[model samples]
Target chain A: MVFLSFVNCMRVKGPDKFWKRRQILKLAAHFYGRKRNCYSIAIRSVQKALQHAAYGRKVKKLERINLWKERITAACEELNIPYPLLMENLARCDIALSKKTLADLAIWEPRTFKCLTQIAAAKNQSYPPTVKAALQPPPEGVITRGML
Target chain B: MNRPISTYKRVQQWAVFGRLWFLFDAKWQNPFDSAEKIAKYLAGKHKPIYHPLSDVGDHVVVINTKDIALPNKEWRYRMYYHHTGFAGGSSWTSAWELHNKDQTKVLWKAVYKACGGSLLRHNMMERLHLFPDDKIPQELMENISDHMKQLRPVPKALHEYTEEEIKNFPKVFEWPEDYVLN
Candidate 1:
């Protein structure tokens, strides 16, 4: 019974160390409470489950930021506003939000974020202006545009 | 009272009502310009008995905050953040919203809110003085701003080290070749 001996050897490695044991115990814990009398068997089978939970924390920060960027980018795309154009428009309007903060707010505060989307939508419907018109102050001799 | 953790500067938290009640007020000083001045007064550093590392100060109260200035452009540009604690629940309002809503509450709210209403904070807040008006009696503030502006004489040099010799010093430790035998 080489397999039985191998299983015994794995049990000595503990529930947090053996790969097969780890997976089985995690699956068991996910689907069934580990309180069953036979759960010790599951624990033996999934020896490294706890280890996986503890040691599997190496997600790259840049990759996470990129993922967030993609989410915001997709959301902006749906509003028909390219990211650069939207950013430029916001800057022109003097919005001082950072990209990371906006991305986080986009994820965490969706309804509030929709207000920004509404602003973008309004911009899309507005009349086209002379390129860089937003960059300049009103002419000295002429009244400011949008003067009522 | 529990002893302070640091060797220098003792601080004790005090129990008090949340609203800043004035003993009296002097002329309302522009707080933003006088933030340093007011902090020194409240912190008790304006006294001749002041020690650099000691916490020997009286509390300060401020009122009539409606006149404080923020950089004018910031009113339109800056955003204050808040959360509703649900997915997609983040929100921000403009500085204009903050100013319009309760400008007087801004600094006081920010200070106490940051301190977060713990027992320790309640005690420390006893030292704060905020007045909402410029009419606080002159005796209450007592030349604090002017006194804070008075400069102390420059201290004599301590002469710890010369800068020129510091550059020639070796930066790293060298291991001995016979470490195992030693």
Candidate 2:
């Protein structure tokens, strides 16, 4: 229907109120008791639930990253390397492995991870004194431009 | 097609998660450092599929515990504390004294500590087989398919070098023939 005047248009609402409440109720379908059926309660719970859902998505990613770091740290410790040093040196060496992939290799492809650690270790000498004391001298063939 | 794919996946799971038996030679190795490495294998940390919740740890057979070397004076300074739970039952035993009482106890304790105080510690410890000498039971020996490398190379004692090897070693200069005896 067309509005006859500006006053008539001002008095009109955009859509039927039923559809809007139905949207919120549909989201609250799994909510408990009155929250699932009553519009007033359902809308509140639905908004809260949606907020939690959004926050949870971000937290889930952060938790996974923390877990990957934990796994990588454990694996690096086994090779007598620090976790930060391994990550920093890996970047310095231009080996662009993500924490998830690095953690995966540490578990399933341990030999490959060990080789990566050796490459990182070879890049630094006399620094990270623990590496010097713990690891044997880097094999003869490894070459790097020192601290360019 | 589904049946074949499912069967292949099943076999792949087994291959990826199969448990392994590892041999560790503790001869001339520092027990503390060796324990850290041994604990990794025992807890299945060396496996890419390792998860704290998963029961994927492997068996470890450690031999020659009697020869484990303690750095510095740890053998004398280190103490093993024990408590019998009775009044005045607590006692501290020096590392050397404990080693004398039981050759395997030192390395055993080292590994136990290295494995951490997790709930699975006992389960992991159960899989550890310790022998004072290199003599492992035939049953255990048959299962060892891999060896854990020692943390440090075993240093060769002067006496261990063959006369030919010692003679062939390069010297800056031969001791002067006229050098007087001490």
Candidate 1, residues B94-149, lDDT tens digits: the string is 86688678755555544555444445445445666565566656765663442223
Q: What's model 2's TM-score?
A: 0.65
Query: Comparing only chain A of model 1 with the true chain A, what is the TM-score?
Result: 0.38
Question: Candidate 2, residue B138: CA error in Å?
Answer: 1.1
The numbered model that scores best in lDDT is 2
CAPRI band for model 1? incorrect
Q: Which stretches of candidate 1 lie over 4 Å from their true place?
A: A1-148, B1-33, B48-55, B109-124, B135-182
DockQ for candidate 2, C-alpha atoms: 0.23
Worst 10 residues of 2 chain B by lDDT: B1-10
Residue A18 alpha-carbon offset, candidate 2, angstroms? 25
> Of the true interface contacts, what fraction does each candidate have?
0.00, 0.24
TM-score per model over all chains: 0.29, 0.65
As a TM-score, model 1 comes out at 0.29
Q: Taking the candidates in order, what DockQ does each have?
A: 0.01, 0.23
Please provide, for model 2 over B96-175, each residue's C-alpha lDDT reduced to its tens digit, 9 standing for 90 to 100.
99999999999999999999989999999999999999999999989999998888888889999999999999999877
Q: Which run of 10 residues does model 1 chain B get worst, by summed lDDT?
A: B12-21
